[model samples]
Target chain A: MRKLKRYGPPILLISPSLFLIGLFVYVLIFSSAQTSMTDIYTNPQFAGTRPHTFVWFTNFIDLLKDGDFQHSLKNLLLYTLVFITGAMFFGFLWAWLLDKRARFEGVFRSVFLFPMAVSSVAAGVVWRWLLNSNVGDRATGLNRLFQMVGLDFLENKWTNNISFGIVAVAIPAIWQMSGYIMALFLAGFRGIPTELREAARVDGANEFKLYRYVIFPQLSPVALSALIILGHMSLKVFDLIMAITGAKFYPTKVPAVDMYNLMTEGNFANAAAVGIILLLVVLVLIVPYLIHTARGDKR
Target chain B: MAVDTSITQRSGDTGRIVGKRFDWGRPVRFIILLFFLIVVLIPVYVLLVTSFKGIGDAQAVRAWDLPQVWTLENWKSAWQGTPGLPAVAPALARTALMVVPAAIISSFLGSMNGFVLARWRFPYSNIVFTLLLFGMFIPYQAVMVPLYRLVLSMQTTLHLGVGIPSLIVLHVIYGIPITTLIFRNYYESVPQELIEASRVDGAGMLRTYAWVVLPISIPSFVVVLIWQFTSAWNDYLFAVYFGGNAASQAPVTVTLNTIAQGSMLANYGAAMAGALLASLPTLIVYIFLGKYFVGGLMSGSVKG
Candidate 1:
């Protein structure tokens, strides 16, 4: 009772949020636990992984044999590489550009960030239409433009093309994101004291060398944080893929879409397995970063 | 965190503001900026021209055209497409319902939780706090399988109302990691004496939180509010799935997807119209709230 007295108010105040979280996190996990035994596909009955079912690793084995799963892995790896590198480079560059004391800094900053405000699904919708190649209304997307200019050699169903579709999907990803990267970079830039760069110049350093030696090192923590954030965002990306190609397209598949497909088809066991693996990958990147930040230390 | 390396111009102690003298880089900077704008505007310009063009003009060899021939036909049809109901308005309303409450409650609770964690030294505090922090790195996908079953089970066993509540709850979970991180840092920077002074009086927990913490946290509050608004308003994954069959419950993201899903030959025009209309709320808010957004992202970046 005494313990309850001290905690009553906070518990009562936050119980709604806690209960809400518990329903989503704990209870849902509990429900999906039935998949450990039953054959989700053929048998339907709770026959269990008994006399007939001795294959512990077969589902995972079968998953690897599937070409779509393999392609999705390749797509995620390539997309994460291009998407993060591009988003960071441009995000930083835009931030750097806006760092100058200028009359139109605010206007330009807002202009860049405006894309981020639109949902990825919506952005995908617009971009998908822009990329369509139908002769009906000419569908004047990028692919269409290339075709008209006799750059038809360069054109294909870009979103459906296994080799180039990732890039096409990533184009909008970068567009929606470059502003966010710009914002983070601007923050890091502002964090820089004015005297440091001037001092670098006094030491006879050029802009390139100065940034390489002085400014870049100081911004490491923020840069790392940004990378982690973008890494997670890129890996977990869904809406754009769904919008541009719906769920089942070949070329641009990622793990989130794969998981969504499995779950939608009611293959909860395999979906759980996939979700667990994806979680592990995200954790591998995130855990160390949190440890670094939580050491009660700052630059 | 200081990145300002412009020490060459910082020589004068008494008279010079930080680069008050016109560096030659200023006008050059604007010209440089124009080049950047063109790169950014290429797709936007293409989308714009194609939106205004008729079918033949859309398919034209030279696609670029000034909007000389103005026509309200696509807009009229789209607005009139589904009887009296239009896509953009209802989506906006649904988006607002999600954004506003999520922003307010998340920020408010976030600041409180942050304050308690940062200031007090109760034994089990960090453990509880860390459990919440567990959600920070665990991609929602990992826990989502368990979580999805959890929500559905609640609908059955616990008799909880589902759908929007379940989704809003999930969003709140997402919001906590970020919002708490922001407030934790912000409150740490806040002076301890202010709380001590209030406690010396007869102020209890609720009063101290209301009277002391909330007023001083206006800036941090604004920061979290904008962050929550964007993440919630722009959410695609949660809305598409957690929101069920009712079109009314769907936010702009889902609605936009539905519009694009159907048959429309005027792909360019409809897409531009849908995209433009969907993004309007955030753009309008941004125009009014520009300064706070920058300050918020910077401060939040440091917290992370």
Candidate 2:
């Protein structure tokens, strides 16, 4: 009774959250793993007639050999590369500029940050209109703007070029998220003490050298944090690409979109396999970062 | 060159030396900032401009032009919807119904869990906390299949409808890791001596938390509330799968997608209006409570 009383309240307080998370997150993941190994058909023709059987790794093997899956993986690789680099570059640029305390700082900051509030679906809808692929006399969106400004060479088929169309899709992703990365980088810039910069200046380190040698090194952790966050988000990107190119559009299709297509088509085993692959890729990017942050908290 | 560098360095130090020196770099910086500002506003300009345009003027070629004829017809049609597509007004209402309860319940549950984990120590609590935090980072796709089946089963066996109520429960569950992380970090900063003093006053853990910790939780509540509100409001993945495509069941995001891609595809004005309408709620929250939103975002990303 004494022991129960001593530990009871805290356990009771945390149990509801623990129970829900366990049921929804852990239990469901295990269930998904199980489903990935078995075949289930939701089609009316197969309903009640087909017996669900464990197919072992057949689904995974099939996905590995599938042309569509290969294309999606390739698209994912290209999208992740472009999205991370573009977001980071623009994020760092805006943060560095704002760090100088320019005029109308509040207005500029709000302008950059406002995109973070809009849903990717909403942004994608607007971008789809803005990236209209029609050219020449029917030029539209950025293309029309380019034509007006005599920068016609800048206009091309955005999200329509088969080989590198995912690059154009990454542009909207960058626009939506670079502001968030800016906020992260801005916080990091502020966290460094003023005394350090003054000390570097006192030692005759020029402005450029001071930043290159002292300031940039201090921001490595922030850069790492932003990279991991952006990396995982790009891996799981769905709605943005979905709204822009639709799920069936092969040029911009990533694994998440492919999984949605498969799931909708009643290919449950294959969908689960794709989902597990996504989860594994995300874990590869996120697990070490989580462990690092957790250890930092102890210090 | 040396004089110019000195002025720049001094401005960096004082941060208020404007107009004291005619620095050449200042104009260049302003030009760069202005260029990016335009880049950021271009799509928004397109959205607003096209939203107000007549159907004839809202074509792809005329995307950058001012509305040749301004009209409220598109807004009306979007709100009231066409024959094939359903109105977004009801979906907006459904989203509100779903987002509010999800935000409130998750925040309160997060507070309690945070209090226990931050202050009340036990064996392997760190491990438990680490395990809970991992759930926040996993792609929902991994669990989407099982979760969908589970909800379906609940609808049949438990008579729990798979509409806003199911969405509320799902959001609250997925929201746990983020909310708990925010609150745990918040409560960690609460001085332990205060808790000890309350304990010396003969109050038990529950009483101490209720009287002591709960009162100081308003700031964290604001942050978590705004974060949860926006995330739940902006969600499309869950809204699509769990909410389904039924006109009565879908949320604003799903409805907006349907409107944008359906017969309204040719009607750019209606599509833009629908997009703006769907984003309005979260945008309003962000405009009004942006500081707390940023605070919540940074807190989630960076440890206190």
Candidate 3:
């Protein structure tokens, strides 16, 4: 009883949080994996309150053959590639420019960083308006600008084009996140001491060579961190796509939206499959990185 | 690469003199950044201009043009909501009710958890921290079906209605990992001597938390509050799946999305207005406490 009292308050204080996380996060993850193996959707009566039939890896096999699933996977890949690259490119560019100690740096920084504050839903809506594809007088935003500048050939259905649909979806994501990536790269740049720069200059290295050999290499971790963050986000993208393109837009569908649709439509097993696939992808990106960071933290 | 040739030739100079290699790149950098600045502003400009325009003006006015006749009609319609659209005011209130309590409770719990994790040493504590951090990255999709069933079952079992309180519990539950992560990292920066001194003075864990740690936690509280509030307020997946079945329970983001997308005839004006309204809370938080927000992001990235 005395020993119990000594440890009881700490246990009480920590248990609620730990218990909640264990139930909602860890256990639920296992349950979701279990759910993906069952044939819950084949017969609703058998499903009742819980999925009973364990179909094993059949759902994964089905997902491989499912065209929509394959398309969502492909779309996710395209979106992740373009989104990460674009954000990093422009982010690094902006950070490098600002690292030069430009005038009104604070104002520029705020403007660049402001988009991080905007919700993805709002970003979707705003970009949807800005990229409206209507021609002539009804044409607005980017399309109108193209026409005015005698670049009518440059105008196209932004998010509506099937070939580039995911790219269009990626635009708002890139916008909302580029500033954040810039902040990361900016911090990375600032952390690179002036001594490093002066030493590189003393070696008669010009700007390009200096950055190529010195600054860029040092920023690999920041880039990798950005990649991990952006990669996970793209894999689980739902709201921005749904908010921008609506839930039923097949062309722009990704796994997160597909899973939502599946679950809402009573395809419990399939939704669980999609969910597991997303988790696998996140694990692929994050697990190794987590181990690496954990090791770093220990050192 | 073209600009690189022109600029890299005389780049060895580091002085501020005009016509130097460094100085020449400055204007070019400014111009390039200025171009991107325009790109950045395009959507925000459209959102602001289109939200105030009357429906006809929204359609007829060139997107880049200033509204010929700025009207309050869109804001009015968005505020009160049309027949199909839910009002923004009530939804915002609902969001605040859930978000405020959840954010506060989670931050407090997170602080205590962080205190124990950082200051108090125990076996497998690092492993425990790792397990908790994994919670942060489990894409909500992975747990959606079970989570939904869990929430629904809890509602029935606890005799609680499908409303904001249930939503609060959901946010608080899922919010634990990130909040804990932020607080743990933040508290790690707090000197260990303070806690040792408090303990030497005969304060127990809970008492030390209340008297010593609580007072010093305000800045971290702000960081966690803004992070959780923005995430909770902006959350659509949870809102749509759980609270979205009813008007009184739906968050502003869900209502705004429904209004924007659910209608047969799209009202760009009102939709833009609703979007702005939904964005205001986070935007205000960002503008006011942007330092903390940036600080949170940096620390979050570095630690994670």
Candidate 4:
């Protein structure tokens, strides 16, 4: 009774969140995993009622052979590369600049970071209009600017391009997130004591050499943290793609968007397969990071 | 942090290298900074200017141009909406009704959970935390199938009607991992002696938490509130899937997307106006509650 009393309130406080997370996160994970192995898509109504006959990974096999799924995976890879590199470069650059005592720091930081607050839908609308490709007298957006500058050749269809269409989408994603990554780097920079920089200067290290050796090395963890955050966000991208390119934009289709489409079209089995694949990829990236953090806690 | 950097700059201005007087690169550096600043602000500027333009001006003007004759007509029609498109105001209201409570309730629950997890030791608690932490990383796509089913089942069996209430429940559930993570980290910084002292006074766990810890938790409350509010307000996936495409049930994000991509015609001016309207809440939050937002982002990313 004493033991129960001692532990009771703590457990009581935690149980509601614990129970909901278990039901929503874990139990649903199991159910989805089971659905991926079944033939439920052949009949749409079988989704929520009960599990259908086990198909034993046929959906995944078919998915591998599917052209659009294959292309979507390629798009994701290309998107990740562009988004992470672009966001990190600009983020680190801005952080470095701001760290060097820029004027109007508050105004600049607020303007750069404000994009983080805007919804992806709103961002997509703005960028879509800004990248509009009308020409000559009817020209708007960048096309008009290109014409004014006598560089009309630089203007193109933007998100409507057949090749490298996903790259166009990455521009807006980078714009929205680089400020966040900048904040992360700025925090990392601040966490380093001023004494360290002074010591480096006393050791005959110039500003460039000081950063190259001491500062850059200390920032690897911050870079890794940015990578994981941006990587996963780019992986599960749905809203931005749909908002910018619309649902049926074949060139820019991604797994998350494809999963939504399949599920909405009553193809639950295939959707579940895509979901499981995404889960595996995310687990591959995140589980090790979780373990690393847990071990850090022990220290 | 910015203050420390500025202090360093002011001290550095005292001619550390006395012989090196030709500093021709300063303007170039400022130019580069200004270039990026323009690149970053152009889309927003375009949206703002376009919203003010008359429909013909919206179509005709270069994206860089300020509206020659700024008008409220676009805002009026955007709020009133066309036949096929829905007004932005109701969708904003529905989203608020859903997002506000979800943000508040989830943050409260997370604070309690975090208090227990951090202060109350138990066997396998670390393992439990590790499991819960995994929830933060899973793509919503991976869970969408089963989550959709679960919501449907609740609708039929528990008689929980679809739309805002269902959305609130989903946000609260999914919000657990991050909220718990944030608050647990927050509570970890509280001196153990305080809790022990409260206990020595014969205060039970709940009373100790309520009287001792809750008072000092205001800063964390701000962080979690801003974090949850922004995310719940910005969400498009859960809103679209669960809330459905119905005008009455739709959140502002969904409504704006639909209006922007209207079937018969796309009205860029109205779309820009609606997009700006939809973005105002979170934008306002950032402008006013920026400190808390930065706090949440720092804490949220540090452990990741």
Q: List ranges where model 2 is wrong by over 4 Å.
A: A43-49, B1-20, B58-61
DockQ-best of 1 and 4: 4
Deviation of model 2 at A3, angstroms: 4.0
Which whole-number lDDT from 0 to 100 does residue B95 have in model 2? 93
DockQ of each: 0.41, 0.65, 0.56, 0.61
TM-score of 3: 0.93
iRMSD, all candidates: 3.9, 2.2, 3.3, 3.0
Query: How would you encode candidate 4's per-residue C-alpha lDDT over B1-304 as one tens digit per residue?
Result: 3333333444454235533444434455567778888988888788888889875564554456787788988788778887887899899999999889999999998898888888875666777777777788888778888888888989999987688889999999888889989999999999889999999999999998899999999999999999999999999889889987557787899888888877214458888899999999999999999989989888888772
lDDT of 3 by residue, B113-156 (tens): 88878876455668888888899888988898888778877888
Off by over 4 Å in 4: A47-51, A133-138, B1-26, B58-64, B263-265
Q: After superposition, how far is residue B279 of candidate 3 from its true place, in Å?
A: 0.9
Model 3: TM-score, first chain: 0.92
- For the second chain, the TM-scores of the candidates in order are 0.82, 0.93, 0.89, 0.91
**Ten contiguous residues with the weakest lDDT in model 1 chain A:** A42-51
Clashing pairs in 3: none
lDDT of 2 by residue, A1-299 (tens): 97788688888888888888899889988989888888774643224366788889888898989998898999999999999999999999998877766789788888898998999888988898888888988888888999999999999999999889999999999999899999999888888877787777767787678879988999999999899889988999999987887878888898899889888898777788888899999999998888888888889
How much of the true contact map at the interface does candidate 1 reproduce, as a fraction? 0.41
Ranking by DockQ: 2, 4, 3, 1
Residues B29-76 of candidate 2: C-alpha lDDT, one tens digit per residue:
778989999999988998898889986784556668898988998898
Score residue A89 of candidate 3 by CA lDDT: 84
Candidate 2: residue pairs that collide: none
Better of 2 and 4 by TM-score: 2
Most DockQ-accurate candidate: 2
Off by over 4 Å in 3: A1-9, A42-52, A136-138, B1-22, B58-61, B263-266
